[model samples]
Target: MQTSPPDPDDLALFRDFVAGTRPLEQDKIAPVVKRSKQKRPAATSNSSTAEKLFFFSDEFEVFAETQGTLSYVQNGDDPHLAGRLRRGELEPQVVLDLHGMTAQQAKTELAGLLNYCEQQQLNCACVVHGKGLGILARKVPNWLIQHPNVRAFHTAPRSWGKHGALLLLLKINQSTEQQFRELTRR
Candidate 1:
């Protein structure tokens, strides 16, 4: 007895069923994904103090509410600092640039500058520290960043010196100057 060959239509139908069960081609699946709706994350509510901006100084640290942490912090935090700097509260003083100065140099120079700013009752001063020579010199420039007399050493605005300089808000001894006058009179 001889077995009959399958029908042409049945053979075609079986081939199609086998192909369908096999892993789909990547290109075919990509188009299906493109047509599907993409679910996105919902926007988070603005609800925390850390999300707001913060400002601090040697003598004070003021926590203020702000819409964004990226805004101009100097003016937004305390108008007093900006006002005094603009009004020349410490202009009569001197500015010392310690760009290439070592840690020891910065320490020595800073002491002298602070004393001078205090004694002379001068205000506006510039301490220019070149953006570190290269990478490995991270904490070197930060010396001035922690000084007490440094009222606010922000990256200077366009009208002021640029990143290469720091505008100090010195805390001088008003009493010392007044005392000098009294001693001279006596």
Candidate 2:
């Protein structure tokens, strides 16, 4: 196919329309700067200090009646939180069973669960530490009291687990606080 040239009149009109425009002065693009990778500070020493501050001492004695319900509320938190937990008003989003684990294992699991709950922004969790011999039953409460994320806890309702389990209310992240507020409002 042979091409035809642009109409002379159309070309003249196009030049008139762009008569005042000037070519750009600097056409070369600026080079991108390569940033050096920053070295992250080591976490070993910092984590050890944090662990010491968040310590769960085996010698920490938790006083509770032999056959009574287990309950706790963090200082300055609403006392009614325990009542709500006991009544099953707040449902647990995660459940942990420490049936056959040793005390150290249970503590480790509990710490990991709390960390996971915070990471996932979950507000509630249940810990089923069987009533057998009451070893974990006693140690669990002591360990829970040391965790900063535990807002409140109460013995589970009969249908959930009764005296053998605990309904834990974890502190909600700021991003999810509104959802919990709306839930409580209803």
Candidate 3:
């Protein structure tokens, strides 16, 4: 909001307008601000909030929503690690293509692949969601974001499926969780 300074011609009128009001007593009062920790759900194309431009933050950069892409990394993640993936330095051993598959089929296949990878301790994998205005391409990113095993995702390079594909970094916590359960077993 923008406002002009009081005009000399209107100063008398302004003073008369506020003649009945006294000055505020604000000598000792200070305001405290509280920041909310809640995170809003990722906006989609149909969402009303989708047009709001979300700016990048200092801690582990995110430029997806405003840039109209799906790439994201958890806050406090090692920048070098994220940079390695972004720079296409990391190659994924496991790559799954969801072309020609329906949404349900793709989810099931992705789940199976992710579960196998986690059980086998596979850290990096690639998923090709296919191109050309498909629903799977739109939905896959959101699915990847919500998956517990997924740590980060980045757009694949030209040779890898370009924007249609994503490189996923997974958190292999199955073994660690098992060991913890055994240690606390009674």
Candidate 4:
């Protein structure tokens, strides 16, 4: 069915009604272009070298308690470091939690953490091994002992996981020591 055209008077009235309105200055908007994230280079070589450098031996006799509190101080260093760590005098700059990771994965992560701490000139770090099956608890101290950067370590205080974690005192360079001293003075 064909419909009749609009009345001329009605069309004229509509045009007059819209005659006062102006057109939009810009109708279309520019499209946004999303940038792709850049991928970081793999540290395979660094990790491999760290694995070789931070080797832990199962046969080595670590005298620390296995399922209980642990403590160790490197030879020729101040013995008070361990006491300070246990007393929570030194704050940990980084904390690593190894709750669900396997032994190998924990080892790799521990190595990477220590390396990172050393590179950043961090003096203290906390490693939480958890009290699961006593596997990592028994091995973490031994692994820490093998790393030369570990100056001293003690079981974390009651506030910091108690027996399930250890506070490590890393061997910082002279410049780091001066910086720490300056910071502590304030």
Candidate 5:
């Protein structure tokens, strides 16, 4: 089969960028799996009837659930997956920090981050809401519970930010799902 030649202008532009940048030694990034970009997980009408257990009083505070305590939740059917995440067996690929940002700002940024993660087919990410007065820390988990794109989240390990951050496990990418189905069909 015939093929077109590489674009000369693109090659020169790429070369210029590479020449100006320092060499990155083997970041060991994984190849991304292409996926159908679903807008969000469908919030069934049944969600309206779902129990609202995420509430806490204004005087209450947030903290990382202590070790040996269950600290993760997954809406999916995989029961043990959340436990694995909390134990740090499933590491995050990226982190989104909401330290100084206001609640509204954090929410906006998280929405964008979840969408971006979905598009990139990232399975895991972390959201750092520092343990300042605890407002952000408390609200972050509630917001994540409402986020349609998130499959699961847990309190991060001490080195990862302890109660100040959360490690998230996103749903499988649609492309990955399709690939799985195709492979099984054969």
Candidate 6:
């Protein structure tokens, strides 16, 4: 039996095969390389929807009810917000008492109040849409359902006002919010 050292050509051929320069004879054993990249969650959902709700918004905030998180710039009554509030540079944060007004009146008042609040750059707001008297008398006002400015509103926390009122996450003018952002950054 003749035992000989391996040829240089065989070693080079093996290296080429390992590097994938030469195709494997066994087609089924060939390793698959994924050529395409994955689509982003937002993009896979749709481009139109992507613009509608992105990671952040100047006018609106991303709120997760389950997680109880808010995306708005929080000044936290620190020196910045307190100073702005004192100088009338920022709008006050309070729950508007709309308890007794009829739905029609409430609707009109809502429009006016929202306009005023936004123009003044007020961020924190609460609307007291009281739970109907005694029994389940009526549904939430039709006007509230139709209002355009109301982005996201929900029942107040138990201590503040409960189901009788709602805490409105109001939208502010982009320019006014820019000031808030500046103050926050500073």
Question: What lDDT does candidate 4 reach at residue 150?
Answer: 91
Candidate 6 segments whose C-alpha is farther than 4 A from its true place: 1-92, 134-142, 179-186
TM-score of each predicted structure versus truth: 0.41, 0.70, 0.55, 0.74, 0.56, 0.41
Cα deviation of 59 in candidate 2 (Å)? Answer: 1.2
Tens digits of per-residue lDDT for model 2, 71-155: 8999999999999999999899999999999998787778778888988999999999989999899888888887788999999
Candidate 4: tens digits of C-alpha lDDT, residues 54-158: 567766657556766688999999888899898898889899999999988888888888889989999999999999988889888998998888999999998
Error of 1 at 126 (Å): 0.7
TM-score, cand. 3: 0.55
Candidate 3 runs further than 4 Å off: 1-69, 173-186
* CA-lDDT, candidates in order: 0.48, 0.86, 0.69, 0.87, 0.69, 0.49
Candidate 3: tens digits of C-alpha lDDT, residues 1-186:
999998887999888898899888879857778777998767445332222112111132223342244566866665455565667776786999999998767766777678778777777788998875566676677667666667788888777877788888877676764653474353
Segments in model 2 whose C-alpha atoms lie over 4 Å from true places: 1-53, 64-66
Q: Identify the candidate with maximal TM-score.
A: 4
Q: Model 4 misses residue 119 by how many Å?
A: 0.6
Per-residue alpha-carbon lDDT of model 1 for 1-186, expressed as tens digits? 998999999999989888847665667433453554877756534342212211112233231321111112233334456444443443424667766677555555665666677666765576555556521123323444445555554434434444555456555466764664474356
Error of 2 at 51 (Å): 3.8
Candidate 3 displacement at residue 80 in angstroms: 4.3
- Give model 4's TM-score versus the native structure: 0.74
Candidate 5: list runs displaced more than 4 Å.
Answer: 1-70, 174-186
Candidate 6's residue-wise lDDT over 1-186, tens digit each?
998989999999888878846554865766899866876555234463443233222233232131221122233323333233223343337667667787545545565566667677676566666665611112232233333444444445655455565555455777866776797566
Give the C-alpha lDDT of model 6.
0.49
What is the overall TM-score of model 2 with all chains considered together?
0.70
1-186, model 5: which lDDT tens digit per residue?
A: 999987999999889888867767997889899887878787635343232322322344343433333255655546766776778877787899898998767766776677678778887898888878876776677667665656777788777887788888777667875664475356
Error of 1 at 102 (Å): 1.9
Instruction: Tell me the TM-score of model 6.
Output: 0.41
Residue 38, candidate 6: how far off, in angstroms? Answer: 68
